[model samples]
Target: MTAVVNEQTSYLSDRQCFAILDRASEDLQNGLALRAFLASIALAALRPEEARVLRVRDVELVDDGTGWLMVHPQAQERREKDSDRAGTVRRVPVCRELAAILQEETTRRDLGPDDAIFVLDNGRPLTAQVYRKVWQQARAAALQAHELDSPLGRHVSALRDARIAAWLRNGDQTAGHILAVAECAGMSAPRLAERFANCLRKPTRDEIPWDRLEAALALPEPSQSTSTARRP
Candidate 1:
C-alpha cells in the first residue's frame, strides 16, 4: 500500500491581504533596497532568489506614453532553466498604482539600466538570505502592528502564495494563466491548487459607472472641433 499525505491549507483573508501589502509598502518607502525587494514581489511577481539577481535593465516602462511596467527576466542568467536555452521573458501591464511606486523609487535612487535594481545599505547586491530576512522582518512588524491572522505567519513564501491566490481569484481560470503564474513563481499548477484551493473565490462583476465613461468620452476632439468651426 502507498502512503498518503494530507497537505491542504487555508488561505489568507482579504483584510489580512491588505494588511500585508500595507506593511510592505510602508517598509518600502523607508529605503531603496526594501522598496526594490517589495516591488519585485508585488509588481514583478519574482521569487526571492530570482529577485536577488534582478538588474536595473530587467524592468522598463513599456512605452513613453503608457504607465505600464515591463519585467524582462532575460537579463538575469539564473532565471534560465536550461543552460542551452535563454531565459524566458514576459511583459506585465501594471496598474497606475504600481507604476507610480516604481517611478518614485527609480527617481529617488537614480537607477540606470546597467545597475542592480536592488542593493543593500552598503551598496552591495541583495542576497537570497538577506532578502528573506528583510521580508520576515516586514511581515513580523505588520503582524505585530495589526494583529492580523496570517495563515503562513511571517514568511516571504506566504507572499508568493498570496499572489497566486489573488491571480486565481481574479477570474484567470485558464490553464495558461495558471501555468504562467506557476512558472514565474517556480512552482507547479497542481501544487498551487492544492495549497491555495480555499482562496479561490468566484469573480464578482463590479458595476461600471457609465456616466463617468460618457463624461470622459465627451471631452472635445481638438482637430474635429476646429475643422467643424471653420466649415463654410
Candidate 2:
C-alpha cells in the first residue's frame, strides 16, 4: 500500500494509545483478536493489509522480548492477484507486551503455521467494518469527552503515526536509525522523515527563556509599552 501522508494527521499519546488497546482487548467481543490486530500496527507499525494476511509461521516470539515479524509484502493494488514480490519479507521487531499477547493468543487458539493469527471467535476472517466498529467503541470507552471530539486517536492509522513519533522522539535520530525505522515500517526513509517532520522538531515552549516568559506576563518596560496598553 502507498503511504498516506497528511500534515494534519493526529496522534495519540502512549498512554491514550494503550488505554484504547486495553479497552478493545478486554471489553469487546473477540477482544483478544482486536488487540493483536491493532497492536501489530500500533506497536510494530505493520500495515492493516499485511496484518490481515499474517500467518502463525511469520511470527518469531522469544522470551527475552526480542521477537520479530516476517512481513510478506502486500499487493499494491486492491485487485492485484499477488504481491509484487512473492517470497520477499520485511522484518519488524515486536515489543514485549505484544509478544506476550500474541503468545497467549496462539496458545489458546492452537494455531497452525498456515492459520491466520487474527480472526473472529467463530474462525471467520476479520473485516474492516468489524475492526473499525471495535476501534470506535474502544476509543469512546478510553478517551475523555474533549479527546473524543478532538482528532486524537480519531483514525486507526494514527496509531502507526503515534508509534513512529515515539521512535523519533524517544529513540536515536541518526540517519541510520531513520532508515532502519522506515524500512521496518515499510516506507522510504525520506518519506518517513517528510511525513513526520513535526515530530522531530523540538517543542518551542522548551526553548523559551524563563525570565522572558515571566516578563511577557508582567508589565512591559516603559520604552517597550504601547500607550494604550501601559500599566498604571
Candidate 3:
C-alpha cells in the first residue's frame, strides 16, 4: 500500500522555488549540482531518494519540448543490493527548464552512463547530511525570516509536493488523468486524490491582471480624466 500524504502539506510557490534554486547556485559551493539536484525534485516531481540514484543514462533530454526520466522503484535501497535491478520504470516528463540544467551537469564532467549525476567537487556522492546543511544555507539566503520559521519550503520533500500539486492543478480531475499523474509520481490514484483534493481545479485565466484589464479597472471618472480609454 502507498503511504498517505498529508492533505495540508506545505508547498513553495513557483517564484519562491526558483528563487531558492538561484540562491543555491549563487551562494553555495558545488552550487550548480545542488541546484540541479533540488530542481529534479521540484520540476519533475521526483522523491529525494529517487533523485539521488539518477544516472546520466536514465535521462532523455529534449531542447524543444519535454524530456524524460526513468525512475526505478525504491531506488536508493534497491541500488545498494542490486544495481541492475529492473522492472517497470516510471517515466516522468522533464520540462525544458530542468533539461538545460541537467544537460550542463552531464556535460560538465562528461559523465558516463553509470556516473552519478549529483556529486560534490571531490567527486563524492552528495550525502544527506551535507545536502541538508546546504539546503539550510540556501533557504536562509532566499527565504524571508518568517518563512524560515514556517512550514513553507521547510523540507526538501516539499519540492516534490509542490510539483505534484502543480500537476493536479493543471490537469483534468478525471480518473484517467489522476491515474497518469499517480504513475509518474509513484503513487496510487486514490492516494493522490485523497492527498491533493484541494488542487484539482483549473487555474483561472480570467482572474489575471493584464495591463489592459488593469488600465480599464483603474480608469478614472470622466470628471477626473479627459482621455477615455476603451474597456479591455
Candidates ranked, most accurate by TM-score first: 2, 3, 1
Candidate 3: segments with Cα more than 4 A from true spot: 1-7, 62-65, 75-87, 202-232
Tens-place lDDT per residue, model 3, 139-195, is 888888877777777788878988898887777666788888888887767767777
Candidate 1 residues lying further than 4 Å off, grouped into runs, are 1-7, 10-32, 63-87, 144-151, 176-191, 199-232
Candidate 1 achieves a global lDDT of: 0.56
Per-residue alpha-carbon lDDT of candidate 1 for residues 1-232, written as tens digits (9 for 90 to 100): 1111134543444455445556655554335557556655655455565556556665555554334333444444444433222355545555555556666666767878777666765677666676566566666765544333434545565554556566666755667877665655545567665665665554455645677888999977679878899989
Clashes of each: 0, 0, 0
RMSD of each: 15.5, 13.1, 15.6
Clashing residue pairs in candidate 2 are none
